[model samples]
Every structure is written in structure tokens, then in C-alpha cells.
Target: MTIKSFSFSQLADMRIEGVGIHASYSIDIVIKDENSSSGKNVYISATGKSNAARAAGTGSLLFWCKVRDLLSNKIYSLERKKGEGFAVGFDDFVIGSIMFHIPYNSSSAPKIELEAGYLYDAGYAGTVIPFPRSLKRVIALTQFNRR
Candidate 1:
């Protein structure tokens, strides 16, 4: 079994007035492989604080995660099981995480690209802000198998 982890810290503040969201966030991603037939699992965790007051029932603050298989150019998005996202208000904070599995054959290793960020929606429209350049990464799974 092998595991790879990456961390990201935001350098600047991000805000979307449409939903009245202002925050600074950090994210951690972990990829784990058990060398089994099932494949690999990817986990994403987001932690942040909201510094401003949210619009009165006008919108919501949400987190998003996406993974891409560089070899096949296929993108897989996180599936939210429970509520949409964190329930944050003025001077509030949130810590949320999601996980998904990717299936692949053992004969070959694929390079994976990951992207994560915040999404603000005002019922009518929405805005998406990527975490940061450092948060977006391309990882080669083969490296983990090296002895």
C-alpha cells in the first residue's frame, strides 16, 4: 500500500458578494492505494473561515473537488452525499471533507490532475474560485511504486 499527500494554503482572501462570502481557506488531499483490485481512493479536506455576513437566504457557500486522469482525459467530480456544503454565517468557520474512488488496471499507472475550490451560489447564479495555483497539481502514481 502507498499513500501520497499534498497541502495548500491560500495567500489572499477570496470573496463572492453574490452570496456574501469572504474567506481564507486551506485544503489537504490524500491519495491511497492498497494494491488491490478495487483501485485507489482520493480524499479531499477543506478548512476555512467566513469573515463576512452571508446574504439573507440568498445563496450558499460550497466546496468542490475534481480529479482528472491525464492519460484518458477523463474528469471525475466529488459526489456530495449529505447537504450541499457548510452552513456558515457571519464570523463562522467550516471544515469539510469528501472522498471518492478511482478504478484502474494494475498493468499501468496514470498521471492524475486534481483541482479544488470554493463555490458561491445565489440561487440565480454562482461563482467558482479555485483554491490557488499551488492547490492544482499533477501527480504520477508510478512514483509511489518505486523502491
Candidate 2:
């Protein structure tokens, strides 16, 4: 798959304090293998960090993801904390370790544009450190007969 990512603003590795909004980006995924089948596993991932741990009552890294399949004309979207839940300490964060399954009836390599955004939680005004991160992979996966 060919992936092209476009960011409105390059997330600089700068310390962010209080309520802040990071950049937004769009990822374009192209399927090169014509044999790739529906229900194929497409991995979409985002990662970043914070300057300090967010308080229990507050959120640090908030992320939003929207995916659109041009071939099937279907759209999937979700939003959640980057750490997947209330987190304190441990600068690392992920979108809950999830994989996006290609929708059915997707014979042609569906053109997908994933839009993502990052925001710092209010109230607690946590500090965060932005990082450049976007992972997308397309692979034809089939059930194993031996299994």
C-alpha cells in the first residue's frame, strides 16, 4: 500500500502547557496488490508523549481519527485518549492498540483518507510534548488452514 500523509502543522517537539491544540493531518492509503481481499487487516496507529503526567482528573493527549473508504463509500471514525484511558506518569501513549479491518465489498484498493487531530485536555491543563507519528499498513491476511 502507498501511504501519503499531509499535516496542517508539523507537530514540533515543544513543551505544551495548559489547554492546547496540536496539528491535524490526513493519511492517504493506496492498495497496490489487486489480489488483496475484503476484511483485510489495515493497521492505523498514532503515538505521542507528554511533558509530565496528567493528573487523575485531567486528560493529557486526546486524539481523533476518521477513516473513509472511497471504494465502498463507507466511513469509520473514533476518538479517545491517546493513552487509551486516564493516565498518570509513563510518557508513552497509544490509541488502545487497535487494527482497522477493511470493509467488505472492497475489491478495488479503496482510497482511504484518515483525518486525525490532537488536543490537550482542559481543566487540569496538563503538559504535553508532541511527536511526529503516523503508522498505516495494508496487508492481505487469510485464515490459515493449519490453524
Candidate 3:
């Protein structure tokens, strides 16, 4: 099996503050081939501060990261679960980070787009920071031998 990898770094810091919550962070996304499978794996890691003040109420605060297959227009949203590598700190008011992974089949086309940001209360209010236009990556996948 052959493996290919791609990495992306944010061009600018992403910041969103509202309803007593605020998040400021930088993101890094990596796409690589799975060692034992034909599919690819997406890894996202965001580092900085994601916090909700005591007055922000008891609603859940989530970090949102998504990837779009430009060829198929399929969007994959990263899940927020501890077992999936999603972990962020709130109310601490200190710099921190979060990460998650998504597995997907290789795209027919060579390019993909990514967007990252934060969401509060499952859509109450959120911000999306898209990858820079120039950063849309063109990836070359290794052709697999068919039995």
C-alpha cells in the first residue's frame, strides 16, 4: 500500500465572540492515506483559546470543522467526542486546543476545500472561516491495484 499526505495551515487567526462566548484560534488540517485501507483520513487540530464566560449560560460550546470534496460537493463535519480526539477547554480562559479525525474515500478530482470555526448551542450563533482561496489543495492519490 502507498500513502500520500497533505498539510494546511491557517493564513490568519480565526476569532468569534458573541453571547458571552469567545474563541480565537489557528487551525491545521492534514489529509493522509490510511495504512490498511483505500480511504483517506482527515486530521484537524486547532490551537488557541475557546472559552465561554459563566454568564454564557449552560448551553454547550463546540468547535466546528468541516471539509468539502470539491469534486463531489460532499461535506464532512467533524464530530465533537472525546474518543474521536475532540477536546477543548471552556471557562478556563487560557490558551488550549482541540482535534478530530474523519475518514473518507478518495475523491475523483484532485482538490478539496476546508472551513473551520466555532458554534454555540448547535446553531444559535457561529462563525465559519474558510480556507484561503489559494490554499485549496490539489492532492495526488496513489492508484490502487485491483484484484
Candidate 4:
């Protein structure tokens, strides 16, 4: 499987409900492997940092890294702060983390897109950093794929 990413900006327009908003973006991905089987395990990982800070009352903005499977049309997502939560502050950036798993596959390279957003008071504001366009870098890993 090959992984790549780019930068995104569409997210800058989103807002939570009452909290502030700050986020970054990356590009999509496409995983292709001939060893794909019925129970092969596939794993994808992504990360980003805040480029700017949102307005006030925005609480601590939240960011997330997501992976989308074009073939299955299913998505596995991860957040920056799993349970610890976020605080409202500028220059206080938190790292987002996400881990996902797929049952298995046969012979298809599922298209993947890496998305991120900032959790604000208005709503989620972010975008799916397009591949070879917006993202700067991206990576993909198959934790364990048994035949």
C-alpha cells in the first residue's frame, strides 16, 4: 500500500457551537495490495497540528485524523485527545490521534482520504485534505494482515 498527503484549508471555515476553532488538513490515500485476503488486517495512521487559533468561547479546539475506504465505503477515525479532552487556549496546540481496523479484503485497493477538524462550539470546521494537492505528507501501515 502507498500513502501520501497534502495541506488543506477548507476546514478553516467550520466552527463548533460555543468553543473556538483551529485545525489543519491533509490529503486522501489509496491502499493497493495483491495480498489482500478475507481476514487481512489493514491499518492507517495520520496526524496534524493547528495552524491558527479560533475565536473566543471556542473552548479548546479539537482536531481529528480520519481514514476512508473507497472500496468498502466505510470510515475509521481517530481523535487528538481520546478521553483527556481539550482546553480553550491559543498557542496551546494538542496532537490528535486515531486508529482503525478492517476485517479483510480480496483484490481491491480501497481509496483513502485523510480528514481533520477542530471541535468548536459552532460545529466541526475542517476539510478532507485532497491528495497531491492540499496535504504535505501522509503515511499508511498494515499492522497485521494474515493470509
Candidate 5:
């Protein structure tokens, strides 16, 4: 089986009471078994940086997936909590990884897609001072262009 990989990066900036905050992050995805020709599978991974010390809190990471049910026209999802398979030390920059599984039945599987979201300094109180900062969330998808 051949492995394919992709990467993404995102940025979020918000202002509350004139306080500016920013966050930025990036992630990588690796497909360990793309040659199955049976179906499609996906994996999610990421890394981030914050201006505040210990901002990420043990470098926590969360992974989520959205799946659609063809028969019912409904969507389903799977998620993983922080500290599942990655680590975030005391450093200002933290890296993490999460894996997702999709089964392609060779005749009934659709392409796999992944999305990611992140919050920076969630618990910080908004003040009148402008902080000129940004927050970022990175998303990566594998098998995105494969049929």
C-alpha cells in the first residue's frame, strides 16, 4: 500500500472590548494504506503556537470527523479527545496527531474529507486593552483528489 499526505494551516483573530487576539496553527495528514483500492481512509494531525506561556495546556488536541448517511440524508461524526496519541509539553509550540478510519467497499464508498477547528486563550477575560493577536487551526486531508 502506498501512503499519501497533505497539510493545512488556519488563522483566527477576534476583538472583544477592543482587545485584539490572534492564533495560528498547522497540521499534517498521512494515509498509510492508500493502495487498497477497496475504499477511502483519512487521518488528521496538527501543530500550533501561542504567545502566552502554557497557553495550550499540556498541548491538548482534539479530532473530529463528519460522515454522511446516504439513505437518510443525515450526517454523523467521530471525535477524539486531547492526549489520546500525541503530546504538548511546556513549550510555546505544541504538536499533536489524530487518526481517522474510513472503509471503502470498492463500490459504495465516497471520498473522505476532514475539517479542523481550534480556540486560543478561551478562558482569558476580555479587557479594554487591544491585544493584537491571532488564533489558528490547521486541517489536513488525505485522498482528497483521489477517485
Candidate 6:
């Protein structure tokens, strides 16, 4: 089991117009089986506090993954939110760990470099002025590559 989070204080010009959100998030990934050996069952989950301080009280939590050795380049993206079912375009997910069947090869566990972020939007004007400045924090969930 492992835990990771990214939090910033003293907003460096960070602001949202009507609805802004602040949160403390955590993630967990674990190997759930030791029998067959391809990719064991992996559980991932995130929880946090979100508040719309500036705009209307409307926003949603989101998650995405791009596993390439578990380390992904840092790129600030609004396209990701609209591109991948998020904000008004996406649906909701359960709070606990979501199970996944991870496959392994070469007698070693599979390693995935994941880069992700969370946001609080004003429904329509996402990452736009009048909306709070969005932040894309790099989350490096390490130690999955070893053992």
C-alpha cells in the first residue's frame, strides 16, 4: 500500500470568479492477487474537500491515466477536462478504491507512470478569466516499479 498528495498554499495569483474549490486528496494502489501472474488486481481511490468559493456551487471531480513506465511529463491541460468526460461532460464515480486487473510480463510487476490533477470549475467557463485560476499539480505515485 502507498499514499501521495499535492497541496499548495498562498495562491500565486490563483483565483476563481464564482465557484472555486479547495481539496486535500489521497490515492492508493495495491496488488490484490498473487496467484496467476499477469497483472494482479489493482485498487485506486481519491478523496478530498472541494468548495466553490467564487462562482456558483457547481463542479465535479475527475480522473485520467497514461501509463508509460509510470512517469509522465508535466503538461497543464484544459483540453484534458473537456477532452475526457469531465466537468459538465462527464459522470460521477464511487468514492472507494476502484478495482483494475493489471497484467505483468517478464516475471516482474508492470510499472506505470501516472500524471494527473483535480479541478473546481464554474460549470461553463472552465480555466477562463472570472473563473478561478486552475492548477495542474503533478502527482508521482512511485514505488510501484520496485518489487
Using TM-score as the measure, which candidate wins?
1
Work out candidate 3's RMSD over C-alphas: 8.1
Candidate 6: tens digits of C-alpha lDDT, residues 1-147:
443343332222225445333332322222232323433444444322233322344555443323233222222212234334422212332223344544444444444443333454446666432222223333333223333
Q: For candidate 4, lDDT tens digit of each residue in 1-147?
A: 533333444444333332223333322333333224554345444334453334343334455556665555676766655346454343443343344445555464334555555443333543222222233223334433545
For each candidate, what is the lDDT?
A: 0.52, 0.43, 0.40, 0.42, 0.38, 0.35
Clash-forming residue pairs, model 2: none
Model 1 over residues 1-147: C-alpha lDDT tens digits?
Answer: 567676665553445543332345455666664533556665544443333225334445455567787756777775342244454554333445555555665456757787665554445564445334224767776422322
After aligning candidate 5 to the native by TM-score, how far in Å is the CA of 98 from where it should be? 5.8
TM-score of 2: 0.43
Write candidate 3's Cα lDDT for 1-147 as tens digits.
333343344343223334322333344444443333444443333332234322344444444556665555766665454223323444321112333222333534234566555334523464333223123344454432232
| The best candidate in terms of lDDT | 1
Please say which candidate is ahead in TM-score: 1 or 3: 1
Between prediction 2 and prediction 4, the one with superior lDDT is 2
Instruction: For candidate 5, write residues 9-103 as lDDT tens digits.
Output: 54544343222343334444454534345443444344443332233232232433343333223344444444343445432233444444455
Q: On a 0 to 100 scale, what is the lDDT of residue 23 in model 3?
A: 31
Q: TM-score of each candidate?
A: 0.54, 0.43, 0.40, 0.44, 0.44, 0.39
lDDT score for residue 44 of model 5 = 35
- lDDT, residue 84, model 2: 58
* lDDT minimum window of 10 residues, candidate 6: 70-79
RMSD after Cα superposition, model 1: 5.7
lDDT of 1 at 53: 26
List clash counts for every candidate, in order: 0, 0, 0, 28, 12, 16
Candidate 2 achieves a global lDDT of 0.43
Model 3 / residue 97 / CA error / Å: 15
